[model samples]
Target: MENCSCKECVSACLNDPGRLVPDDILKLSQFLGISIDDLKENYLVRVPVTSNGHTAYALAPAKKKGQRYIANPGTVAPDYYAEEKGRCIFIDDRDMCSVHEAKPFECGAYMGCRNTFLGKPYRAKTVEEYFYKRWKSK
Candidate 1:
């Protein structure tokens, strides 16, 4: 179980899209076989961003066997930025996610390339619903 102070846990949870609840923190601490304090100090890296797109919290997909974790270009038209104001986090010069290490677990589980937010096991309010609406539209 998490034996750390709320301050420590909150510091650790910042910018983490996983949004680990207290129970999850406890489970993770138990799984890591370390004190929650240590986990918070050593492993957690916070990177808070202004919430933007549906895929903001999406996990990076797993690489194919022996391949690297490269992000693919989204199906946006060339005039996407001209038409829309927001920026995409996935569009690196090399087509890789900058925050690949901190990506959510859902991205790691995705198999369908065309699918936006792949949520089947659990229901999240934002990205999950976004995917549902997108899929329904198609």
Candidate 2:
């Protein structure tokens, strides 16, 4: 969230993890020095997102159960579930993000984070719809 320090945004990682846009997948892959497929298989969870009464698939930085991200969160083709949702795997001991340089788009762009990377504030659903389109295109 850049220079922001709001509690809700920071504490969000404690339960709900941030959503990822399509470009974030590639950015995170490059940032971690891993292939796109590796990032998808290991770090991301494919989850269902809904907007306008329709459902689509999208990605999120996986929530962790132990020291690792939960496996098979990407259960099926489009409507997958994380089952036991947990904290963000990238959160450090100090409760700060370790991947700020390539953090998920919603983490940096959403109003909950107090840093509007999209130039202005937007409803969370608006952001979700944007991501939904991007994922559907892929």
Candidate 3:
């Protein structure tokens, strides 16, 4: 079987690099030869999940003009969901991921227009739990 070069997938991810899971964060840090703490401080942002009051740590989206692509709609009753839009910081001028080997789970699973299986739906709590643990450790 021929290997899938992931050219299409990478193209789609270049447009919208989706949220990162906790494990992705750790892996990304290691791939970038940095500490988890440094990765979080430098490249991650706390996004509120509306389904729960907890905040999930996600890769910081790239900025354009004076606006951030990630938009937090603020806390709403019952759920405090925020929305992330835009390309990942790791995506370079060539429309490729700088940390493709350590790309987040969402990025890895995305199949672009091919519509392949992209894994199970994300559980915000898992990310929130990771955030709390990391927060406590600090």
Predicted candidate 3 versus true structure: per-residue lDDT over 1-138, tens digit per residue:
112346676654545445566667678878999887777666665543322454433444332212443432221212222332355667767766688676566555545546453443445555445445544322
RMSD of 3: 6.7
Q: Ranking by TM-score, best first?
A: 2, 3, 1
As a whole number from 0 to 100, the lDDT of residue 17 in candidate 3 is 47
TM-score for each predicted model, relative to the true structure: 0.30, 0.75, 0.57
lDDT of model 2, residue 29:
84
Ordered list by lDDT, greatest first: 2, 3, 1
CA lDDT of every candidate? 0.33, 0.70, 0.51
TM-score between candidate 1 and the true structure: 0.30
What would the TM-score be for candidate 2 when compared with the true structure?
Answer: 0.75
Best by lDDT: 2
Better of 2 and 3 by lDDT: 2
Please tell me which predicted candidate would have the highest TM-score against the true structure. Answer: 2
Clashes of each: 1, 0, 4
Stronger candidate by lDDT (1 vs 3): 3
Model 1 root-mean-square deviation: 15.5
